[model samples]
Target: MKKSITALGLMSGTSLDGIDLALCSFNNKKSGWSFRIEASETVPYSAEWKRKLREAENSSARDILLLHNEYARYTGEVINRFLNGKTKPGLIASHGHTIFHQPQKHFTFQLGNGTFIAAETGIKTIADFRNMDVALGGQGAPLVPIGDRLLFSKYDYCLNLGGFSNISYEEDGQRIAFDVDPANIVLNYLAQQVGKEYDRDSLIAQSGKVDDTLLKELNDLPFYNEKPPKSLGKEWLDSELVPMLKKSSLPLPDQMRTLYEHIAIQIGEVIHNSGTMLVTGGGAHNPLLMERITACSKAEVIIPENKIIDFKEALIFAFLGVLANQRQINCLAAVTGASRDNTGGTIHLS
Candidate 1:
């Protein structure tokens, strides 16, 4: 048996939701690894921070660098507040906010300075988990599958509904995972048009009707037919998805309903097999969207407790940090199409 260690994981998803912090303890037994969530919280982004991140994709190089350090300090401050009076974790693992993710160009950038985080918090930090995979010609994404395989293998599928939807499962003795479709990214975009932050359980979507034409167009998207190991980025949404949505003349509610149906159809097509699928991420909270998914598939959707639904990614990142510290394989080649299975993450010591 391996000695148990506690670690704090920080996640800033593309949904621009907030910084999710999860403190978890992990132990490795002969059977496998097991973990318990000690605590978790979300620090919502201020309007200024949100706007800066939203525009980061277009920001100048100097500005990007400045924002990177600023965000790192902000993350450290959040961690400091959350950890006040708590037992200190052994490590801090951060999945920094993604500013650019064009793996095809052999580049992906997640902005949070690990050195700064470690300096500010006086804790060893691990971050920038994707660049090595991209350098090895991989998608460097959907990295959560390794956690699913080790921690939640009972389910036939594991799906995360964050800014985008991604699924992971075993096939022919290897773990396979990839981005499925846009989820909260599109939903939140439409919700904002109506002066709301998000659709809130997809209530706005449930109140309207699905547009067949829009559904068909969404279904016909070329990326959907691409082979596995592919990932989607904000650039794709800005260049292709949002533009297509703008072409439609539907009302806000109707657009939400139509996109909701589209997301369901895309996800259903991938996991049509009959078995239990563990669902997490912000999208799991959308009951109406969940209904749409159930209506279109044979699989049973199992949503765990609220804490699991909201902070699974952060917990997994913490687990990934544990693996990295041990020099164990954390990122899988089968999932990312990298040259080989390898450990990926940069560590910073204060």
Candidate 2:
């Protein structure tokens, strides 16, 4: 493949944090597929934009469509600002901000318009990576496993703590992945209540006491009892999680601490509390949470370099674009329970 391919990847995760942009170079060598992050940055979302995205979860059909195009334009502008005069990559791969992801209902939708992105940036764009798997009677979630299997197979487990926490690992000669539990989504919401963007190393949670009752309730969530090939979404958060948290009269810090411990416990259950695991995502930066995870589990959680922690999702989305262009399998049926392994994504020509 002509030495290597450079692609720009954009990720608007469920965390309502910001858009992550990574310009990555990929090479398929005799050894295996490898990638290098040439440049990357995260443009934090404005309060106004974040409010619109959160509210769009239940907005009218027409409003959702308008927001889709508006978000695409916003994404493109953010990319333009980040690129600033740097050379454009060959392709743009985006995991558009998920406005709705109800796989059980047989539909999933991401907000950024690929056609609009392509037109704005004058680069071919690939997005909407989840719909096909849902259509195939699969979870249509956790599409990142293919990249985990191909790019970071050295670790026994790959855990990402973003808006939500999800894990991927090899099992019985097949790659398995699924959401673990809520992470930054809930944490950030609580932080906002205290006028902070996040817990800042989870100081809030660390300084407080974990309410045992809340911890028990969180651990008892029915979603945890489900088998593999499952997923979670904002609907679950609103309908199941938020109301439960609201019932607690504990202070915000105690609530954060309880949930943090709960997240650690749920994650520990998956790894059986042991293995060499690679942890990445914005949540990786929370030293307090990381410490709790280590204390609760026997797993060796290795937090990688900063760029890898921040932009790995973006890099993987870019790899998905490369695979989609080549008609290669980028979404694994074994992971998402799709009818078959499929090359996910739709290409929008420049």
Candidate 3:
């Protein structure tokens, strides 16, 4: 295995906030793995791109294919601009925008074709990191746990507050992780109702009152009751959660407040009585949500610096690429319920 590797990781999360690009270097030693984010930036999606991605799932096959390649080219262009005058990374690992993720149906698709990425950027690229696990009868979701276990072992629990919130930690002798609940995705949608991109610092939610009735309904969601090795997707949100929120007839602020409470409660139930939980991702910026989480859970919540909170997922995806390049396991059966531990990326040479 190489002693050190520098890679650029690109991540477009479910929240549609932007494409996060992080230039990172990883060093492996007998003791453990360590990493540094050399440079990072998030290029926000334009209105047109956002609309296309939001509706890609419902588009025709040909249209979806076209958008897939177009998105890859766009990603490549973004990388070119991001890399100008900077140290060029040896590889590009992209967690492509997910168009559909239904592992139970035996398929998952992430846009941004690796071939196009490599051709455009003229660098080795890795993409499509989830389908193999799904093909192996696994959820093919929550692929971040291996990174959490190896790179963030100091924390008793590593919780990411992304488009959706997922928690990873060691339990017994194995790593345990699963999607906790919807976080920024729902919050952003509610904020849009009020002509805001997102509830800044969760101010909207902080001012509103939580509706107990709505809170109870959200708490009783079947996904919350499902066992670990399970995951959630936008499809589940649309079919299960969206309708429930739509029927509430509550003010948007109240809905956001209740949703925040619901998220806190679900997370508290999972990490209850734990020691320390490292929280990152965009949701960590929402002070009100953090307060609610601290109020409901026993664990001490630690939010790292802004760069980490914003770019941790991109950093982990880059680590996943490094592991794949070394033929090391990046997806764990204990976390994703695959038949066995596996390396899960398709390498596209430049």
Off by over 4 Å in 3: 1-3
| Cα displacement (Å) at residue 256, model 1 | 0.7
Residue-by-residue lDDT tens digits, candidate 3, 1-350: 76578999889999999999999999988889999999999999999999999999999999999999999999999999999999989899999999999998999999999999999999999998898789888999899999898899999999999999999988888999999999999999889888999999778998889899999999998888899899989999999999998888898888998999999999999985659999999989888999999998889999999989999999999999988888898999989988988889999999
TM-score of 2: 0.98
Global lDDT of model 1: 0.93
Candidate 3: pairs in clash:
none
Superposition error at 196 for model 2 (Å) = 1.7
**Candidates sorted by TM-score, best first:** 1, 3, 2
- Give the clash count for each candidate: 0, 0, 0
TM-score of predicted model 1?
A: 0.99
Supply candidate 3's per-residue lDDT for 166.
96
Across 295-320, the per-residue lDDT of candidate 1 in tens digits comes to 88779989999999999999999999
TM-score of each: 0.99, 0.98, 0.98
Collision pairs in model 2: none
